[model samples]
Target: MEKTFTEEQRNFKELAIEFARRELNPGSRERERRGEFSEAGWQKCAAFGIPGITMPQEYGGLGLDTMTCIATMEGLGYACRDSGLIFSLNSHIWTCESPINKFGSESQKRKYLPGLISGSLKGGHAMTEPDAGSDAFSMRCRAEKKGSHYVLNGSKTFITNAPIADLLLVFAVTDKGKGFAGVSAFIVERGFPGFSTGSALEMMGLKTCPLGEVFLQDCEVPEENRLGQEGAGAAIFNSEMEWERSCLFAAHLGAMEKILESCIAYARERRQFGKAIGKNQSVSHKIADMKVRIELSRLMLHKVAGLKGAGKRAPLESAMAKLFISESYVQIATDALQIHGAYGYSAEYEFERNLRDAIAGKIYSGTSEIQRNIIATFLGL
Candidate 1:
């Protein structure tokens, strides 16, 4: 299906593309190598109102709908080489900010949304624990009511932006006997007593995106800090997941197109057996497949965005999009690597890095296996 974007949305995409080329493309490799999170780059994005695109204007945001946000993110991925940075930004927006915007009380929005939108305050979502990777709701973290506050005691690992986040939306058990419904969400700030970040994790890719553990020992959050009701964490988390699964990959579809272009360029220039690699059917076919995947993935993403913008539930669509695009990304990266042959295997080209980053897509934001399960359940399995 052909999708049409508004003039304002087109302008948003153009602005994001320009900003990405100027700010994110040049130093992406070096930043990844040094494991450096670019405060300067983030500030540039903030100045462009990237952090506020989907937020309300009253809260210092652009209040763009879902489609505009996806368009902007796609432009960023097309022009930017920093996948790690894009991933981190998506995590902050969908997982942290969107939840607050959707579920937080009016006072909570007033207290946190502005800084979050302006990039003055960074946010992270803490849900995964050491024992609860794919089965994320199987958490051991506990929060007990004490007076007017909830005393939290738990540890969450594999948390994105944990080391540098100013605010955290965390999930813990308020009633352990209630299984998944027992989980509750809280908004915790940095420097809260007994809240500390663990060591930074060394990841295969996305090095510039800091991942760490959050330890909450007797951390006190007032009743007002609670995101929703005591048993609303699962609902809130599922909503965020729908947003994250659908939108986080918008950038990736752009990257897939970029990779395709790069591979085609290499195939035409690099000669083998007295002819360019493009002359070979294998090389041409790989490029063809890449183009097909890019087009299909883009369509799926647009569908999800449209559904979300129309205030419709999109669990099946989100899962399908996430499953297909993530696996397609891995395949595209692999084909790009193969087209480059030995150069793709080396650090001299970005293909290797793209391959490494693609591996994580299949794992995080719900794994391919988990997505399949979700799809099956939707089919009434």
Candidate 2:
């Protein structure tokens, strides 16, 4: 199906593609080798108006609609090979900025939105704990009210940008006797007393975007820093995951497209036996299947984007999109690698890193298993 885009949206896509290639593409391999986060590239993107894509224009954001935001993100993934940088940027935009822009009060927005939009402050959400990866509502971190402030305790693990984040949205139980409804969100700053960060914990892929543990030992968060209603933490967390499920995989889509193109080129040029490898039925079928997978993923993603643009609740669509796209991305990457043979397994090629990164996609933002459970409930199955 053909979809129309506004002239402005088209311009946004072009700018994102060009800027990502020219600015975010430099030294990606070397930076990943050193396990470096692209702080400089992050600033460049913020200056380029990425952090504010879905924010209100008054708050120093571009105020782009959901579709435009999706298009720009997909463009960035297409042009930028620094998967870690892309991951960091997406988490910032969708998880942290989007929620604050929607739920933060005028005063709260005034205090944090500008700096976040301006790239002066980095932000990430902390919902998962040591025992609560997929079961977010079961988090053990707690926050207790103490007169003028809330005292936060417990720790969060595998928090993105944790090592260098200036701001964090920590979700903890305020009244555990009430279960899920007792959960609440607090905005904790780096310099806050009793708030500490641990050393970075590395992974197989996305080394450029650092992850670490956050510790809060009676950390006092100001009353004003509480996001939304005290018991609405689960709501906020669910909404953030909904947005992440719908939009976070736009990068994966772009990466899959790139992999498809690379596989085609490799098959066309790499001779097997007497002729180009693409002439073989196996190679051609893989390329065709890759194309099919990309189109399917694109359609599913666009469906979620369109619903979100119309200010619709798309929890079902979001779950389905994330489930299909994340799984398809792994398959597409595998097929691309299979088509490339030894070259795909070699570290010199970007395909290997993409495969590693794609594995994490199935695990994060509601794992594939969790997605299935959500979808099953939606179907009354």
Candidate 3:
């Protein structure tokens, strides 16, 4: 489906593509292989206003609309091969930056948003705990209120950008008796006393994204640092997820298009049995299926964007988009690998890396199974 984007949106996409080609495309594979986080790349992206795409200009952001942001991200995915970097950026903006923008007080925003938007300060979300993976709300961490400050004692695992994060949006239980509602969100700075990051954890893909544990050993945060009202952590978290699940896959959608182009180019150029592989029906059909998936995923993503821009609740649409786009990415990667035959299996080619990275999409944001459950529940199951 062809989208009718405004001239400004189109311009944003072009700018994003040019930026990705110049900045992110080169050395992406090497960085992924070495598990090296690109501080330079982050700075470049910040200069390009990527971290502040959806933020208001008053707080050092571009303040682009949802559709423009989606278009720009899609362009970035199309031109950039650094899936890890893209994932890290999304986690920072959606999970960390958005919460602070929406819930932070005037002083908090003044203190953090500028640095965050300028890439001088990297942020992370700390919600997932060792015991809470799919059940993120079942965390055992506690924040005890004492006079003017809250003493936090907990450890969060699988935290993206933990090792390099300057600021973290952490959630802890303030009153366990209230279950999910008992949780609260706080802006914890890196140098806060008793706040520390654990060693980075190795992962299948997004290796350079720096997943790790954030430990709070009686970490004290002023009452003013609380993100929202007391016991509003779960609500804030869910709201952030709604935005995250809807748009986090924007880059992956572009990646699917990139893989499709690569597969098609390979099929037409590679000789097999005295003829190009594109001459073979099997090879041609795989390419066709990849195109189909890319188009379908794009349509779903566009629908989600439209819903969000219109201020409508898109829990169902976002879940469907996330599940479909993630699974489609994995399929496209697999097909691209198969099209490359033996070469695809080798680390020398980018197809294998794409496959490895694609696999993570199915698990993060929300697992495919979890998305399915959400869809089923929404359908009155």
Candidate 4:
């Protein structure tokens, strides 16, 4: 992988690591404790061009390839301890910015992409309603056309960046008779009538990023804001999911790399019965397993990223990758906590927080079960 990277990617990765360590890591524990969103960190990341890694240069993006994006994000994960901020950044780029870039009309792209990529605007999507998580297409949100506007009604929960987002990619049922095909997506501005965000919901992890509900009660959206065609929401959603599942997990690979290193250092330095605890088979084997998981995770991430970079749809490969990497992260986090014993459980070290954050990876993007189902369907099972 090192040999395969372009010189630009290598340089970008190194710089991203340095930038994140210097700018994003400070006060992370305090932000996490307060469940505060880092506006300053967000701007710093924007100024550093983290949000525009794969966007077109014309639209204020880096115009880099998918591999470069993943490599840079992996570096971000390795150096940045603030997982919530990273999560929010990924949601902004993959769900909000990427979908608009791919499916929006030229006018819409010109209107939204620059601000989104430039970091002046924060964006997230409202797809998971209270009843429509894994079954996202079953959304109860409805958008009815009325002259020059569409009136939207329904609520979306567990929305990332909701509390602070300037724009949102909202999906709704435009024609219930057509089922999933009836779904449509719309770009909703924060100032739109009847569109409001709920108070932030506390979570076990990723607390530094705001999460909340989006309520659309007769929210009036301009016709020009509709993304793609009238019934293209399902396709738009699937595309975003593919990109997200393929790319967002790169951060996890970086994180696992960090966790592995910490575990090794602790195992080597901590004394036990005779010498370093690393000499014990139990402790040493766990650290060895961490390395194994990280390498395998890296291979899977690279494979999916390669497929995406080649302009291919990799539903099967991406599902396999998401399932493996997410589950592997949880296991790695568990082993890391175990390796540190009492210290790991304590908040003084980040192991407990890392575990909390890792658990969410399994639930988001699609649960481990959902990924298995996707892979099974691909197998014609």
Identify the candidate with maximal lDDT.
Answer: 4
How does candidate 1 fare on TM-score? 0.97
| lDDT against the true structure, each candidate | 0.90, 0.87, 0.88, 0.92
Name the runs in model 1 displaced over 4 angstroms.
1-3
lDDT of 4 by residue, 1-381 (tens): 355568888787789899999999999998899999999999999999988989999999999899999988888988898999999999999999999999989999999999999899999999999999999988899999999999999999999999999999999999999998999999999999999999999999999989999999999999999999999999998889889987889999888988988998999999988799999999999888888888888888888899888988988888888999899889989999998989999999988988999999999889999999999998899
RMSD after CA superposition, every candidate: 1.4, 1.4, 1.4, 1.1
- Measured with C-alpha atoms, the lDDT of residue 73 in candidate 1 is 88
Q: Residue-wise lDDT of candidate 3 within 1-381, one digit each (tens)?
A: 136678888788788888999988788778888898888889889999999998989988988899888888888887887878888999999999988988888999999999999999999799988899889888998999999999999899889999999999999999999998999999999998989998889999887788899999999999999999999998888878878877788888878888888888899899978999999999999999988888888888889888877777788999999999999989889988998999998888778888888899888787999999999999899
Candidate 2 off by > 4 Å: 1-4
Better of 3 and 4 by TM-score: 4
lDDT of 2 by residue, 1-381 (tens): 124557776677678889988999899999988999887899898888888888888989887788888878787877888889889888877778888988898998999999889889899988889998888888889899999999999999999989989999899999989988999988899999999999999898888998999999999999999999999898888888888987789878878878888998899999979999999998899899888888988898988888888988889999999999999888887887888789898888888888888998999898999999999999999
Off by over 4 Å in 3: none
Name the best candidate (by TM-score). 4
TM-score of each: 0.97, 0.97, 0.97, 0.98
Better of 1 and 2 by lDDT: 1
User: What is the lDDT, from 0 to 100, of the residue 17 in candidate 2?
Assistant: 82
Task: Assess the local accuracy of residue 152 in candidate 4 as a C-alpha lDDT between 0 and 100.
Answer: 99
| Candidate 4 lDDT trough over 10 residues, lowest sum | 1-10
Candidate 3, number of clashes: 0
Q: Which lDDT value does model 4 have at 259?
A: 92
Q: Give a tens-digit lDDT track for model 1, residues 1-381.
A: 114678888787788888899888787888889988888887778878888998999999998898899989888877887877888888999989999999999999999999999999899799999999899988988999999999999899999999989989999999989998999999999888889998789999988888999999999888899999999999999999899988889888878878988998999999989999999998999999998998899889999999988988899999999999999999999999999999999998878888898899899889999999999998899
